[model samples]
Target: MNAAQIHPLARSPLQSGIGASEPDPDAIVASGVHVIDVETRALQALRPRIGAAFVAACRRMLECRGRVVCTGMGKSGHIARKVAATLASTGTPSFYVHPGEASHGDLGMITDIDVVLALSNSGETEELLTIVPVLKRQGTALIAMTGRPESTLATLADLHLDVSVPEEACPLGLAPTSSTTAALVMGDALAIALLDARGFTSEDFARSHPAGSLGRRLLLHIADIMHSGDGIPRVGADATLSEALVEMSRKRLGMTAVVDDDDRLLGVFTDGDLRRALDEGTDDVRTTPVLASMGRNPKTIGADKLAIEAAHLMEEFKINALIVVDAQQRVVGALNIHDLLRARVV
Candidate 1:
């Protein structure tokens, strides 16, 4: 069909003139739909093929008392890096090794304590095979992800994860598109399985990624962000409203805890309190005790509670801060939304 008439294969079905030249909209739509179909088939085919071999691979890597050494070449090398990252961030310790570099001096990095996961679509990457014999001699467990089961890499591996497809999604049957995606997803499956097998928690994940946002959400304790000891904006119930405001300013937490003579949390007075008090002509009334203007039973969380919970309190109450207290109801610390922001949980 002509571009004007439009067919499924036509490059431009609706040629329009805004001010100038016409464009081929049909061809773009056809090419895009074709690409989506190809990718969807590649992904859907993995369902039935995820057999016992995947589980065995996970068990091998989980039982491996050492690191996971991921090796591959070209596009596979990029996927290898992601696999290594997923392994490390989950429960297993893993690192990527270029197949070419392993042939030179990097092969020394592998040991019997490690497990090797090699990726090659053809299963015949020469650099990868060059070191297989040495690894076998060292007794390192080997896992292969390849399309060709009869290929050399598959024959040498202790566990073979068949990532084969009838053909690659590449229209010409040449590019590595579909195979690489399948191998990468399989690597993710292995990483997550090992993570579950190890009972890896978010806390464990955060420990490994201490600089990431999850680390701050899970690891930054109340004590990490709380204003402690003299830095806490606290004043006695007998103190005047003006005195509490001074304390709030000095601590910069926007509120002051009103406590009993024994340092027990009695209530909290904030700038909001100051405004309310002034509306009743208490601004000039310095004689009013801070407790008289305080919010009795102000929201509180434990010093041991997660900072994420603290962020939640601030969001739920539509306030900026909260009191940190011990089991005895003694004010131990304080934190504001800004603290959570600095910690990256906000």
Candidate 2:
């Protein structure tokens, strides 16, 4: 087949308006720098606009009994979706509804107690306007983020947040570049303000993100991951150093807790203690009592303490293992650095 028949729509570099030459690295860098500078100025202009209207929007969301329903069209829709996710992940309860979809049947997702945050660069998106009447009839509060103050969407809103940018970062001045960034930043500001108002803590954040690394670090307790019962390496205070070594090897914890007759933690014998004992030319391991070589006043953690706390204790003292104790200081469990590593709590 001829070249044209084989590739029906393919064009030469010149036909594609890209000259048959490599692009200039310096020119590409300059374009990127210009875009960043434009977007930076847009964010700076948006800062002062966050006064009364911004605070009012925050108050409406903070007092909302239902979710903050974010809706927009085109690029604004993308920003709205991200804003919804941010709000949900923070302290505020929120979700996104497409304005175009809302015009169909997604409007049912909104309720009278909800606060709708609508975004439009020109404040004149037809899809958003089509649902405004229904939202009003239902008594849902409206918050508009727009570039034009007098436009239909802005004027229709109970409160307006102006995300107007001086110009677009796009060289053609036709793309939603700086405008989208401004809207996203405004949404973040609202979510974080509500987060602070609700006194959201890291633990609360962890509860919502249990599958993430931060959740494992913050929510995992010693009782959840520590080796307990037969899994814990332990020996009586009267056990020989050789017996303690055998217990440590069998449990593979690199250490063994030294317990009293009633199973109360007396001390711990670890690889480090063994090294010190050998370096000091202590008595034979088969005959010497483990108590003579065990570390006294060893660090211990409660079963209810966070796993990350155990990691901190290990690091603070340069120790690799910890004894888990009950309220009466009885040895209930044991864990080492490897335990935290396996659970990814470290």
Candidate 3:
């Protein structure tokens, strides 16, 4: 992927930075503040309007045996797509269907048990009205999200949700700014209400997003990623420094776990320890027992813990490798920073 391009005005106004041309910083800041204020007011106006209709919409969706079909035109269409995705990811099954497509053969995708959520800021979108009668004929339930409750779509709908905003954030009041935001927020409210009703859990979310980082954190355990059996670099506590160096080199983990005769962890020897030993003028390291030169009380993690927790432990201790031990404190596995990187859990 290409590196992100920095915004020209990211720096403070007082800074003498190079740019195409200097803009009025006060005007820029004021414009952003004005937009935010307008949207905030719009959302505030909507809070009091949420009542029976909103609750009814959520109830219908919770009881829906089939999927929730979201349909809209233009800007409302974009928000409708996002609403559908959020609903699907949470717990409810949903998908976006373009209003224009319903006029052709796509209307067949709707079923009798489905709930149709139609969005149109004006409440008079021609494409949606053209097929509303057909969907009604199929005995499908209709939920209208529009600014005008008296419009044809809203009057015909079994439930009407008012996403009306006081005004657009645009100076000329032509673009769909505050209105679109209001509609998006209303969609989120509905999705979350349904999510809570269904008792959705994080594990369920991870199942839907198995390729995402959340899935790795929830499903991947230390045993799944750690180097096990013969892959672990280890040496007996009585082994010579030369023997430990040979084990570390062969395993390529940059460290070796020092264990006793019963395979219990005792200490650890690393390349850093080797350097420290040399600086101490221990020239006889070749024959010296590794226990005398190893670092005592090395950090270790249980093999049953989550991989992400192991990652946090490594980061907190500023170490690149961790020894995985069983309940008996016997070395069962080993892992390095590169292993977490390869697993994409880092």
Candidate 4:
């Protein structure tokens, strides 16, 4: 890999503080690149011969009504687990089933509606074949991924996806490296193809992953956990600063919504404002109206937006809170960084 060439505007040996004894940058980059070269060679090896077989594999997964049961042995098992996760996180519902365990009665996990994605570089794994007959009897479709097109696993599969590589990236030729990476990428390709075919939106992905940041971004709606009704700390803009401070403390959101008589969002008065006001050496409870210290035009977001969008907006503006407003600019609810954190949006 070539190192990024420095531009004339940014080039200067003085910018580099490395001592003269430091190793040559070319050798340093090449040392790391040699490993990448091996992996690249393997992926390049998969690019060819991906004709009808890849299409068959995708069709098998697309026709699947039940979850995709991924099974494999050894390092292939590790790769299978990741493929299963990718499938599940995308559109396809999937879970990893250990082949060894499947032989020990876990084969019961395979249902008639499910589709099997079996992995084995050699196209043969004794533990995997043990349950193959049962899967066949149960009417479950099988999709095989292997380096050998003529192997038993491929022969038994309803659809065979050839993931052959000329050689392993491992120096010993014993470890599974490039082959496994190819399998992983192939699995990802299948998953994304299915995701696109099914019109799997990020919102759908978030529903499947309600615990992750993606889930928070997609599944969360303002109406689901917004500070609404009376829990919303709100006060009229003409209210005294003392009144606003009481509302902020009582609401415990570190901020108070400053609204007009018609509930239109006039501005916002947060703890930061209070601090700044007090630091200006004014008495904490002087006759200053809440409107006097509030932001004239506060940033706002819609209630239906993904929480990730809200976080991005807040981050870009260097603000901590955002008021949820309607089409008419009426304040419906409000939230801050901590709310997003608690909701796992961050």
| Candidate with maximal TM-score | 2
lDDT of each: 0.85, 0.91, 0.90, 0.83
Q: What is the lDDT of residue 70 in candidate 3?
A: 95
Q: Give the alpha carbon lDDT tens digit for every residue of 233-338 in model 3.
A: 9999779999999999999998999998989999999999999988998878789889888999899999889899889998999999999999999999999999
TM-score per candidate? 0.91, 0.92, 0.87, 0.77
lDDT of 4 at 336: 80
Candidate 4: list runs displaced more than 4 Å: 1-34, 245-255, 260-262, 269-296, 326-330
lDDT of 1 by residue, 22-72 (tens): 545655566567656766677788767788888889888978899999999
Superior by lDDT: candidate 1 or candidate 3: 3
Model 3 ranges off by over 4 Å? 1-28
Which residue pairs overlap in candidate 1's backbone? 11-26, 11-27, 12-26
- Candidate whose lDDT is highest: 2
For all candidates, the clash counts are 3, 0, 0, 0
lDDT of 2: 0.91
Q: Which is the better candidate, 2 or 4, if ranked by lDDT?
A: 2
Q: Please list the residue runs of candidate 2 whose C-alpha ends up more than 4 Å from where it truly belongs after superposition.
A: 1-20
Q: Which window of ten consecutive residues has the lowest lDDT sum in model 3? A: 1-10
- After TM-score superposition, the amount by which residue 177's alpha carbon in candidate 3 deviates from its true location, in angstroms, is 1.4
